[model samples]
Structures are given as C-alpha cells and as structure tokens.
Target: MAEISAVKEAWEIRQRFKPEIWFSAPGAKHYENRYYANHHHSFVNISVTGEACACRCDHCNGKLLQSMVGTPTPLEMRRVVDQLLDKDCRGILVSGGANSQGEVPLLAFMDSIAYASQKGLKVLVHSGIISRETALGLKAAGVDQVLLDVIGDQDTIHQVYHLNQRPEDYLRAMLFCREADLNIAPHVVIGLHYGQIRGEMKALEMIREAWPETIVLVILTPSCGTAMEGLQPPNLADVGEVIAKARLTNPNIPITLGCARPSGQYKRQVEILAVDCGVNGMAYPDEETVIYARSKGLQTMFTEECCSLIARNV
Candidate 1:
C-alpha cells in the first residue's frame, strides 16, 4: 500500500510538470502493433569491436553485439554510415564491447563518427568507462550523446563486470563527459547484481549529482548463453519503486524506460507501472500500455528514434 501511495504521489508530481508521455521504437529491433509500426530502417546500431569484448560482463557476455552491424575499422565504419545514409537512416548508435578496463575502443573510429554526424546522422555512442581525451574527441566529433552505464556499487562492478574499478570510477567518467561538455545519458540497470537491487538507488543519486541530459532506467533481462540466463528478474514492485523514486527525485529530468528489459507479462506490467510512475518516455513499450496512458488522459506521442533521443528535444 505504501508503494502504491508512492507511485500515486510520483504521478501527481509528474502531472504538475509534464502531462505528455512519449513512446519510441528504434530501428534496432522490429516492432509493430495496433497502435503503430516501427520504421524498419530509420535508426540503426553499429558494433566497433564486432563480437569481441574484454570484460564479457556476466549478463551480456558479448552476445548482444552479435545483432549490431560490425564496423571494427574506421574505413568500415565510414562505409556502413554511407550505406545507412542510402537507406534513409536518420541516426546511428555506435557501440562496441568494452575492454577489461571497461572502455569501448571508440577513439579509433572518431573520424567515421564525425563523418556520420556531418552527414546529418544523430550519433549516440555507448562509452563504457571513458577517458577525458576520448570524451573530448567525441565532443569534437559533434556526437549527439554519450550513453554511459553508471553502476553505483563497487561489488557489482567487480563481480558482474569483472573490473577493478569502483563506483567513484564511474562517477569520474561522468565528470569527464561533463568537462568535455558532452550530452550525457546515464543508464542504470535495475537488478544488475544477479536480480538483486544492489545499487540502483545509489546509481540514481549519482545521476542526480551529475545532472545529465537524461536518465535511462533499464531492467535486467536475463539473456540466454550468459551467466544470468536462469536467474529471475527483479521483483515488479521493486521495479516500480525505483521508477517512482527516480521520478520523485528528479521531478523535471526526462526519465525513460530504456529498451533493455524483460519480455511478456513482465514487460507489460513494467510498462504500465512506468506510465503510472510518470516516465517522460519509453522504448519499445507494450501496446496495451499505450492504451492505458490514453485512458488516464495523458497525451501520447510516438517516435521512430531511440528513446534517449527524447532528451535532444528537451
């Protein structure tokens, strides 16, 4: 009952500020429903490291990279960008496997990224633990946003990510992006510690301190062939609590339910809770959730771009 009241309060706070909600379906995956169909080629994802990853995090183990377009070299990245442009692609997410030190090898492909940005592509980079030089380079390349996973617990960092880094290290990376004046979109994965809510709230607090352009919350979706394949996702009530607290803490920031989450009924419930909790946007939202938002008298809008791109307009 207390959790229910908290969600209600959060919704009220949201209504006081922004009454509109946005649904996004990026081209990374095919999505269609009664409400809308995704633009199959509007946006795309690229992997600079191919199927390689040094960290090989327990939850992902580089399997997610298999679905992305492989552009390991600068030349290949340029070629892929040109191909995407011909397909009428409006944006591209340039991501790759992180190294043992949790850094994506993005510096080598800066020129290609710049070329894509120059060609009017909104470029979003998944920078794992970034350095100042790389941050500055990305900013110079005119990248649209730098997406960084902000883990707030050192134990999760060491155990799941297999890194020697601490929570402060993640904070420092955000500071680097801030120094470079790059638009930061920090992603906090709920139940990253093997379906346990270890550091998500702390992660949200860190994001509040960093003052990013947007805050993205993704629930853990145990993937096959990974260490967490057999694990259950976090409790639905807990997921709602985190989303509600995120809304309450950052009343005006654009909080989004990102694309990485569980499917089926769990996905449906989370999407409904997100709408009730007052998230500004959602990625790949369930069809019924869209109808529910309308039933509650909330204005709705749909976009074919990544949910994080909503911050660009804000």
Candidate 2:
C-alpha cells in the first residue's frame, strides 16, 4: 500500500520541487527495494524521570521515553556524558518525563549540564511547560538549545495532553526561551489525535510569532499500550501540507522531521515532500532525497550533531 503511494508521490514531488531531507532512523532501512541509509546525528536523552511522564498525552503511550538513557542523579548523568564524550558525540538532547505541573526536572541539574558543555558536548534539552525562572537556569547552565513540544489548541491540550494548560501557556514557554537568549526549537506534533491534522497550522503560526531558531516537526507514532493504539497516524498528504505551510511561513528557519514520525513509506514521502516545501534542512534526511537534492541544487552535508539547532555556519 505504501509503495504504491510512494510511487505516485515521487512523480508529484518531481513535478513540483525537490527539497532536502535527513533520515534519523537507527540500524538500517530500505524503501521500494532500494537501500537507504546514512550516519546522522544521534541524541542520548539522559532522563531524570525515566518513563514516568505526568501528562500522559493521548498520542504518546509512555513508550517513547523508555528509549532514553535513564539517569536520576547527577553522578549518573556524568557517567553517561563521559561515555558520549569518549565517543565524540556532537550533542545530547537531555529529556525526561514531565511532572504533574507539566515540568521536566532538568533545571535542578544545571551543574551537570555545565559539566557536559565543559567536556564539549553540545546539550539541548526538551523541557516541559516552563517558567522564566527555569529558562534562566538553562541559559546560565550553557545549554546550547532548548526544545519544547507546543500544542496550538486548548481542546488538543485538554483532550490530548490531559492537562489544564491553555494554548497561551505554550506561548509563554516560547517567550521564556526567547528572553533567556537560548536557541529555541519547538516541536509541533502532526496528527496528534489518532493521525488527525487538527491544530497543526496553529502550531506553525505560534512558531512564527516566537521566531524560534529551529522547528522540529515530529509526528505521532502509535504505541500498543496507549489509548490511541488502534488509531492510525494522519495521512502523509495532510502532514505534507502542514510542513509546506511551516516552510512558507518561516522560510529561513531550519525544520527537521525528527526520529519519531511514522515509519515505512509514510516516512519517505513526508521527508521527500519536506524538501520540496523549502525546508532549510532536515535532521535525518532520507537517502533518496539527499541524492536527489544534490542532483538538483542543494549542497547536502552530514554532521553528527543534533539536527534541530545546527548553526547556520555549518
């Protein structure tokens, strides 16, 4: 089913435009019987709260956080950093499960963040809904980038996030990052409600107003244990539409198809469409798109650093 769609979508992409994409999947992948693989940036989320997120959002079943490296203490964090440093890591996306107030307890570990920076690890954190005070702490700690998932609608927030947050709360969080002079990279999950496109465009507009340095477009992936397991992800056409809107809205800003989007040709088609839509760059670009972009006019490059906030210089 996906292969047939990819064939059709490829013709559409060639007719419209060719955009750059990066593939961030670990191990290996093949699309339409052609090998697609690349060495891209990798992140070790040294989680402080393990898999226990407070929000328990409708789209995520608490399975995603389990992939992060669990580190509950400063010493444990240091150990993880030490290993990543030895391996010459480009950066780490320090993240964890949120607490009841929609917060990730990363502020308390400023010293650990500082330690990682001192050892030459560029650190980016996925914070929960935050206050100015917390943002200040992250800045003082030398965090290279800070990422937050921002929902645009109150219904999505209430129904999906199961929290009492208004959409404005997400705006406040974006400004908090802005005021602290940190590189802000906000994520807007596409098809967050069983693969629906509700509130996605609003999320893009919020990003434009915030003027974030980078935006990550991670889509919803179903987990078997969650309430939404039986639900399907939003269609590639819908997600592609949102990505095109985001690119047109924020032309210069970098947009990434993060590692969390739906798999198979849904991944390839959305990624290929991302390049067509004028995304500045992608974190883990698909191999076919990379080859095609080079064939067109883009100067495709690879780096081991986190794809979200890669500086314009490189």
Candidate 3:
C-alpha cells in the first residue's frame, strides 16, 4: 500500500509540473510500431575499443560492443565520422569497453572527437570510471554529455564488474565530470546486482550529490553468453518502487527510462509504470503504453534521439 501511494503521489507531482511525456527510439536499435516508426539515420554509436573489454563484466562480457561501429584507432574513428556525415548523421555516442581500471580509454581519441564535434555532431561519451585528465579532455573536445553508470555497492563493483574499486570510486568519476562542467547523465541499473535491489537507493543519493543533468534508469537484461544469462530481472513491484523513488527524489530532474531493459510483456508493463511514476521520457516504448499514456491525459511526444538528450530537445 505504501508503494502504491508513493507511485500515485509521484504521478500527481509530475502532473502539477507538466502534462507531457516523450518517447524516444534512437538509431542504436531498430524500432517500429503502430504509433511511431524510427528512421533515425541521424544518430549512431561508435566503439573505440572494438570488441575488447578488460573488465568483461558478468552482465555484458563485451557482448554489447559488438553492435556498435568499430573504430579502434583515431584515424578509423575520423573515417567513420566522415562516413556518418555523408549519411546525414547528426549525433554519435562514443563508447567502448572499459579497461582493467574500469575506464573507457577515450583520451587517445580526443582529437577525432573534437573533429566530429567541430563537424556539427553531438557527441555523448559513456565514460566508465573516468579520470580527471580524461574528463577534462572530453570537455575540451566539446562533448555534449558524459554518461556514467553509478554503482553504490562495493561488492557489485568488485564481483560483478571485476573492478578493484569501491563505490566511492564511481562517485569520484561523477565528481570529475562535474568539475569539468560537463553535462552528466547518470544511469542506475535496476537489478544490477544479479537481479536484486542492492545499493540502488545509495546510488540515487550519490547522483543527487553530483547534481546530474538527467537520471537514466535501465534494467539488467541478461545476455545469452554472460554469467547471468538465465537470471530473471527484478520483479514489477521492485522496478516500480525504484522508479517512483527516483521521481520523488528529484522532482524536477528529467528522469528517463533508457534503452536497456527486457522486452515483451515486461517491457509493456515497465513502460506503463514509468508513465505512472512520472518519468519524463522513455526509449522504444511499446505501442500500447503510448496509448496508455494518452489515456492518462499526457501529451505524448516522439523523438528519434537518445532519451538522455531530451533536455536539449534533440
């Protein structure tokens, strides 16, 4: 009952501020439905490390990098950017596998990143446990935003991510980005700790301290080859509680249901709960959820950009 009331209160709070919600379908994934079809040729994702990851975390094991365009060298990255420009791509997410120290090693490609930015492309970097130098370099390259996954449990950091670091280390990365005056989008993965809710609230607290521009919440979708391949995701009630708490914690922040998560009925239910929890936007929403949002009197808007870019109206 308390959880129910909290969700209702969150929804009410959202209604008081705005009567609209956004659904995004970035080009990272191919999506089409009755309500909206995404032909987002203007956005793309690039991997600087190709298919390599020193961490090889339990949930991903570098499998996620396979989908991105591989540009392992500075010249290759520049070449890809040129090709994207020819294709009329306006934005790119520069990400790659994390190293042993849990960093994405993006400093080496700063010149290429700047070149892309100068060429009129919005750049967002997924920085894993960044350093001060790398943070400043990203800022210098004119990167529009830095995305970090804030983990609040030391065990999750050590065991799941195979990082010889503490929760404070993740917090320090956020602080580095903050000090660089970069737009920080912190992602809190629900069920990150093997389908259980551990340290998520603490993660949220740390995000509040960092003054993030947006909070992106994603679910742990078990991959086939990873250690957690068969694990079930967090239950609906748990997902709802976290979403509601996130909205309540930052009433004015643009919280988004990001692109990662399970599909099928779970996806539909999660999207509905996200709207009820007053999430500002969602990525690749189910067609039924779009209707559900409209029935609740929300003025639905659609976009082909990443949900994290909602604040900039990309």
Candidate 4:
C-alpha cells in the first residue's frame, strides 16, 4: 500500500495496480447473483423529474435516472410502488435532481412512502443535499435509510455541484439525520478531482464527526456530454486504501462499493480490493471479485438493494 500523498503517486500506482486489480475476477457471475435476488433489490431508474434528478452531475447526468418507472406525482409514486409490490419487487429508492436550492423535494414523497410501507415495501432515499427540516420529515415518514454525499473541499463543492455551501452544511445534514434516528449511509466519491483520491479521505474524516451507520465508497466514471468524459478512474489500490481506512477506523461499521463504481477492469479491481479490505457486501459486483472473495475464505453475496443492508449485519 502507498501513502497516496500526491498525484504522482496515484499515477505510479495506477500503472502498477492494474495487474493486481484482476484479483476480483473470480466471483464473476451466477454463483452469487442470487444473493440479491430474493433478499434485497432496487429498481434501476431512468428519467429526471419528480422521482428523477435535475442537476445531473458530471459523472452521471441523470442517464441512470431513466431506468426507474416514471412517477411524476405523489399519487403516481404510490401507484408505482403498488405495481412494484405486485411484481414482487423488493422496494424502492426515491431520488431525483436537485431543486434550485440544491436540495431534492423529498417532502412531497414522504407521506406516499408511509402508505407504501403499509404494503410491505421498504423505502430507501437519496437526498442529494438536504436541510434539517427535510431530514426530520424523512425520519417521521418511517423511511428505511437515507444516503447523502459528504464533500470535503469547497472547490469541488462549487465547481462540481455548482452550488456554494460550506462543508459544514453537509455535516449538519448528516448530524440532523442521526438526531432524527434515520439509518444514514453517507457516500464518498473517489477521483472526483479528475481521477485522483483527493477529497475522498477527507470525506471519511469529516464523517467520523457524525454517526452514519455505513459509508459507501464509489469511484467517479466520466460520462459523455459532460466535463469529464474519457478521464481514467482512480487507481484500484487507491479505492482499496480508502476502504481499508474506513474499515480500520470504524471496524464495526459496514463499508460498501456502491453501484456507480467504474466499469471494466477497474470495476473488477474494485470488487477484489473490497474483499481484501474486509467489505461485508457489494452492490452489482463484477464476477471476478466474488470469486476472489471465496478464494480468500470469505463468504460472498450480491444485492440489488441499497448498501444499508450492510448496517444490519454489522
């Protein structure tokens, strides 16, 4: 493992890390796909309104949002949840683009989720950036889990999100959720600085200030029609380094590799590194990582459900 002290070190690590990154390839497919089948799952989203996002960040510009069934209104969301239950869908993760204030209008869907909960549909939510009032409302709605991005640098905050708020605001939001007793999963994106682990470690340090049950680490992938198209992903070892750090820091809490991690060898590498670092579970993991975990004497499983399930086991 390297110190990850400079971009030069990251570049050097990237070239050397590729060979070792292949460790995740063993658990390639089918063997563990069922782990998420009957147990935990999430509906892929498409579209970018009501239940979709508007801000569409550079790494993902709402293209992923298109997979979710359209729910443009509260009642519409209720109908969709009903349909989901009829289809035997596990539950739903409600998210959308940010409003002008950089917050998702989650209050609109809270009551509707309460109704869905009655039908045995668990609800996990992604509130891009939030205020205290909304956090309280989500807790009152009986929401299952809440995920928020915790940023460390004000520069990445303003440049990437195009919103100006101190790191304290995000800290406040996470603390608020804890106060309301909401199951919180804070996210830290690696290589947000054009393919380097700049703000990620800082995010972990910041999260240590609060009480999120779990923290999901995902690497940024450059998407077309955006500012970061074609930029390489962060080194796999860098991803592992952070995961190992998070594991050592909170030994008891669950750390997950979220759905948006980089694709191809980088993706496989991430899965393998997760095992070495003692990751409890993974979301949509590449086949290789699963195989590697088994070889290393770890029990492997996959889930389409949100990473918060990791909290329950920990």
RMSD of each: 1.1, 4.9, 1.4, 6.4
Model 1: ten consecutive residues of lowest lDDT: 305-314
Q: After superposition, which runs of candidate 2 have C-alpha atoms over 4 Å from their true positions?
A: 1-42, 311-314
What's the ranking of the predictions by TM-score, best on top? 1, 3, 2, 4
Estimated TM-score for each candidate: 0.98, 0.85, 0.97, 0.84
Q: On a 0 to 100 scale, what is the lDDT of residue 155 in model 4?
A: 78
* Model 3 bad stretches (over 4 Å): none
Candidate 4 clashes: the total is 25
lDDT of 3 by residue, 1-314 (tens): 22889999999778655677889887778889888887756689999999999999999999999999999999999999999999888799999999999999998899999999999998999989999999999999999999999999988888899999988888999999999999999999999999999979999999999999899999999778999998998988999999999999998788999999998988988889998999989998988989999999988898877789886542
Residues 78-194, candidate 2, lDDT per residue (tens digit)? 888888777656578788888766778886788998899888777888897988998999999998988999888888888878888887889889998899998898999888856
Model 3 worst lDDT run, 10 consecutive residues = 305-314
Whole-model lDDT, model 4: 0.67
- Tens-place lDDT per residue, model 4, 54-89, is 566666566555555567778888777777677676
Compared with the true structure, all predictions reach lDDT values of 0.90, 0.72, 0.90, 0.67
Q: Count the backbone clashes (under 3 Å) in each candidate.
A: 0, 10, 0, 25
Worst-scoring 10-residue span by lDDT in model 4: 19-28
